[model samples]
Target: MEPVSPDRVSDAPDDRFDQSVEALIFASDVPLRDEDVARAIGEVTGADTTLEDIVAAVERLNAAYRATGRAFRVEQWGGGYRLATIPEQAGVVRALFEQEAEKRLSRSLLETLAVIAYKQPVTKPEIEHVRGVGADYALRQLMERGFVDVVGRADAIGRPLLYGTTDRFLDQFGLGDLSDLPTPREVEEILADPRFSRERAQLLAEWAADNQPPPPPADSSEPVGTRLRVVVSSDSPPTPSEADDADG
Candidate 1:
């Protein structure tokens, strides 16, 4: 004879409630919307469950997991809630599999990304306008790396696709938002590093001297290392060597 079992009407479903919910949240890749949770609950119980109850359940799970110091927790992402590790634990996670973080983005990619970051939602043509060269390869590279995405179609004559940065782009660049990026002056300074070779620094220094006001007399000295921005013509492309040196 089969062993006696717990009552079917009450015990089993109650015991499995949290486990089923956990599984549902865990298995989902994108965040699960609140309505999706309600539908799942209704399917399991054969009765509609309110969105409020699902939220309450999720809140309880979040609280319990917080107290437990679990490796992962439920997070809101992509407009839905899903389980994810705290970002601070990234090093631990990566080390568990013995991986080194990848190299920084190439100079061309960084410049291209920077242009898009400032001008989006912009089309490739617009990016080339500011960059003064075709941006096709850089755009393809950014898309492949998940740094940029097709955000919309441009309103121009041909309706080219518009591009914008992904959330991953922000994470990779350590920026809180697009507004956190350095200004043109800062970018110029960064590109003027001595490691770029003496000729490059001289060019930047000459450019700076030509554009900036003369130093004030000793009593009213200007701030050190501040440089004025020289506007470049949108029609003329930067020379490939200057771009390569700047990239360096």
Candidate 2:
């Protein structure tokens, strides 16, 4: 914030500045950068707004939101500021935009993503070596989902492309930056959770159920879920009295 000259030292400029910052952050679909806000407001107001000023204005706005019990507030993530719903409203937000089944990542994708997030700027071959599988499909899906991007090319024999997590990845996962990623040891602790293994078993069960062949269709037109009954006939012969009665 620059020192105001005597003519314009009233509360209107400060109020308008705060309002302008709020409008910019509200209008941006993605995270809004403080520098962008400062530049835009500076050009509009002829006031040299600094990043610190933008930050302070955001704080004031957030304090207002808290005071008013708003459902959302501005949050700093992925190197920029974005409006984020409060944690208590998370359930409603998720319900409004439920994740589709097709978007669900399989175990292989999770493993590959973890490897890339932890050892980013790494090559496909290195990822494969760690995961013991080809990374072509995983890399393709991650790139398609805007989670991973090619940072550079490795200086190996072929100069393979290097992959790293994108800012979208950080924003999607609620991470401020790569530093927010859990360490390998922490991941190990998560893997050791009994619930994780149980969920793995559940996935296997669902896969087995999906891949199993359908039962042979019944010729009879019995309704679905109805029990079937089988009656067996005796094949043994009768005694001599039954034979004589048959002859008579």
Q: Pick by TM-score: which candidate is best?
A: 2
Model 1: per-residue lDDT, tens digit, 154-209? Answer: 88888999999987776556554676676666766766766555665567667766
Q: Candidate 2: misplaced stretches above 4 Å?
A: 1-13, 90-104, 184-248
Highest lDDT scorer:
2
TM-scores of all predicted structures: 0.51, 0.65
Model 2, 1-248: lDDT tens per residue? 32223354447756688789999999998888888898888788788888878888888788778867999988878878899889998677777788443246789888998999998888999999998889999999999999899999988898899999999988887787888886566777789998887786676566655555456488956443312211112124456897899789
Candidate 2 TM-score, C-alpha based: 0.65
Q: How many collisions between residues are there in candidate 1?
A: 0
CA lDDT, every model vs. true structure? 0.73, 0.80
- Give Cα distance to truth, residue 32, candidate 2, Å: 1.0
Off by over 4 Å in 1: 1-19, 50-52, 102-121, 129-134, 164-248
